[model samples]
Target: MAHLYRRRKQYWIVYYLNGNRVQESLRTDNERIAKDKKKKLEYELALGDLHQSSKLPLPMILEAFCKYMLRIRTAKSYKNEVSRLGYFLARSVTLSSLCRQGADEQRTMLHL
Candidate 1:
């Protein structure tokens, strides 16, 4: 069974999957839609068809972007492309955190 609740001014749907608790934001004030989404999530969970990677971590994505840039951008204009990429990466909360450690540290951290 799934349940809906409100917290911090947002409504969320909660359910169980393989005995693990899962939660998703409904982002609506309508209780009816919240309840309906909760039920749908629970049903999907029971069917074992959840696509978790549809939600990718930003750091992982940043690493992939770096690899892509390396393969496509030349060394002469690499700095320009890196700067542009930084702007794109900054939009992700997870990637923004990785940027704070300095570029060298971030590279080493991503390697691990």
Candidate 2:
């Protein structure tokens, strides 16, 4: 079984897997969606997995961006693009956090 709760207006699920407690954020406020996610998690836990596949790492994403930028931009511009991607990734913010902030602030940060 799982324990469902809300924190900072986000739904989370806590459950035991293989005698260990695991807590994860569902990242949604909707109860229906939270319930569905929790169900899926439980099912996956029964199968001895919380995820079916690994997500792309930050370095891999930056490498792809670098590859794309190299094809179109000047060397200096490509270097700046790589640096900016590294800066954003280092901050550890999610897309939702970016969307919640003011556009001007995001623009200033993106320019760096």
Candidate 3:
């Protein structure tokens, strides 16, 4: 199930769709508006009108990844990897840009 949370006066919406997870950070000061947007997204997901996570903006992936890893990574080896990668990610571009770059890099590497 999807959930909503607020951090540093910003609201974030999170959900899963099409076997892939999705998230969006609404830079709104109002929690109610954030919840409304979240509900609308949930409705779209339920209707299957929203495409896979890849189709959404790349920022969503970055936010989702960090959130997921921080909350769920329990294995020592996996945690270490995330921490190491996060250092690079935190310094690089915004989550959206990083996601695009990462995806493109993966695609190119796969063809090598």
- Give the per-residue lDDT of model 1 (tens digit) for 17-99: 65667787899888887777777777777788875544677676666665565567664454456566667657344433434
- Leading candidate by lDDT: 2
lDDT, candidate 1, at 6: 95
Candidate 1 segments exceeding 4 Å error: 8-10, 53-57, 72-84, 90-112
Candidate 3 lDDT at 66 equals: 51
Candidate 3 residue lDDT tens string, 1-112: 5799888889987787766666778889798898888888878877889875346665776656755654565445434644566677675663324345354443353332
Worst 10 residues of 2 by lDDT: 94-103
Model 3 per-residue lDDT at 54: 43
Ranking by lDDT: 2, 1, 3
**How do the predictions measure up, each by TM-score?**
0.49, 0.43, 0.44
RMSD of each: 6.8, 10.8, 14.8
Error of 1 at 80 (Å): 7.1
Could you tally the backbone clashes for each prediction? Answer: 0, 0, 1
* TM-score-sorted candidate list, best first: 1, 3, 2
Q: Report the backbone clash tally of model 2.
A: 0
